[model samples]
Target: MFEDIIGKMRGDFDIKPMEVMNLQPLVLAYIGDAVYETYIRTMLVVNKKTNVNTLHKMSVNYVKAKAQSDIVRRIMDKLNPDEQDVVRRGRNAKSVTVPKHAEITDYRYSTGFEALIGYLYLINQTDRLLEILRLSVEA
Candidate 1:
């Protein structure tokens, strides 16, 4: 089912996998932000059919920078060395834009979290990605 949706989105393009390490951390975070929001939105809709406004509010609790930062901190010890390295690289990646609502530290940590998600998705590690996302939600 997941593959079907993604395949349709890619539509006849023979997309080849790129080397994950070559991608910039911000690029990873870009995709990761989308993936994370999609997952959170799906989970919320699946668990409870609420008004869109209510659902959006609920998702904010999970997707906000502070929440993501806290989730990553709580689960850091659970990550493998490679995953940790990815997160570290993401956390250290410099961004020129300042977060309007989040502290710098929280924003950076959230970027690291998103990068991990993006890295896993790019590598086609669905199970691990789902696991980490589940852990983040649970945390």
Candidate 2:
């Protein structure tokens, strides 16, 4: 499913399995954060038809550490083995500082969620990535 999407995006995009396999967890999380946020923002605009401020508020509500943790708990059971492993790696990753108002658990889960997104994107699995994200938010 993902390969088809990538193929349609442009002729230049190629999915090299070895390249994706070499990515570090932190690098995945870094890319995933941006991908996830962009998806959230796009979804909000398309579904809610709201103003910039309203979109910002809604996006924040969904992307925050606590919300992401809740999402992870709800969807973890549905994830594949590899996805679960990715989440575990992200959860176990060490961060220098915790969010001001969020719980450590929430932050960890959020990081895991971002890592999953990053992993999917890195492998050019855009369809699966979008599907997982949609399922997560809708749940």
Model 1 C-alpha lDDT per residue in residues 1-139, reported as the tens digit of each score: 4444433543444334467777899988998998889889888998979899999999999999999999999999999999998899899999989999999999999999999998887777777888898898884
Candidate 2 per-residue lDDT, tens place, 96-137, comes to 877898999999998999999888877777677878888877
Give the poorly placed runs of model 1, Cα more than 4 Å off: 1-18
Assess the local accuracy of residue 75 in candidate 2 as a C-alpha lDDT between 0 and 100. 88
User: RMSD of model 1, in Å?
Assistant: 2.4
Q: List the candidate 2 regions with Cα displacement exceeding 4 Å.
A: 1-15
Candidate with the greatest lDDT versus the true structure: 1
Best by TM-score: 1
* Residue 13 CA displacement from its true place in model 2, Å: 6.0
List the candidates' TM-scores in order: 0.89, 0.85
